[model samples]
Target: MIMPRGSDQLLLPVNPFFIALTLLLAFAFMLLPFGRHPALPDLLAVVLVFWTVHQPRRVGVGLGFCFGLLLDVHQGALLGQHALAYSLLAYAAISAHRRLLWFGVVEQALQIAPLFFAAHLVSLLVGLAAGGMFPGWWMFLAPVIEALAWPLVTIALLAPQRRAPDPDENRPL
Candidate 1:
């Protein structure tokens, strides 16, 4: 027998409150003591990409811009550096959302790697233009770390919505 189309939907709704809370948690994680690590992963960017891919309408470039602005203020970086980078990142994610959604999480992670790199590259270029010292070759590490973390993040965020498989498929829940 075929499963009902409605059953394919996640059991839990994607609540905006949870999304906001997750973003706040990611921001706090970013603030944790990394102690001058040049290659720290941007948890905020990862969270942004996660939400953008899963809920494009609710979490788009505007949210990215706001979060990036917050990050800039927190980091004391030249204003608009992260805003520009995250806006670009959101644009890239929005552009690829359809295709990315069709793929498995691992493939999505692979596909998203370049977008993460582009965001970092934009930030680096902006920082350099503003007379900031080069952060070093290790700066490329963040994207790699982010990409690797993508599947794990997806699973974690989505786990609550996943329904348990019916033990008796012959019966409907």
Candidate 2:
């Protein structure tokens, strides 16, 4: 629904408390034990996509870079590796927002998953160029995991935003 005068959209504001809580959650996600798996998916990436596409006014490239840097620190990977990927993801999401919205969940997953794959590839190339060691085939699990969760998470988390505006608010301007 369109917000009334002086009322803001549903996007959450970026405040100190929000930043701190976000950092805490990011850290926890990176460190939480999950039976020797890499969480089978990038929860952090999913989060970035959600905010970037739906509430871009609140979350944009800078925040993606910030979160990616935090993830880099937590994962002990090359700094700026994930940051680049994350910011790129945000850009892609914002650019493709129109096409993405019109597609069904299944169709959207097929499309977005490739972008996720490309992001992973870009990160891998950067790491290699920087002389960072490879983590081997198991690392490829990321895209597959990304593919599986991309649609489910988006549909579950952001579908609310697609709902029609409350009809009673209609009025001639």
Query: Could you give candidate 2's per-residue lDDT for residues 1-173 as a string of tens digits?
Result: 65577643353234545434554564578566664353256777766775676666777888889888987887778899989999998889888877886777678778788778777888889999999777677777788787778677765554444444553556411
Query: Cα miss at 151, model 1 (Å)?
Result: 0.5
Pairs of colliding residues, candidate 2: none
Tens digits of lDDT, candidate 1, 73-126:
988899999999999999999999999988888999999999999999999999
The numbered model that scores best in TM-score is: 1
- Candidate 1 has an lDDT of 0.89
Where does candidate 1 clash, by residue pair? none
Off by over 4 Å in 1: 4-11, 164-173
Clashes of each: 0, 0
Q: Name model 2 segments beyond 4 Å from true.
A: 1-27, 33-39, 159-173
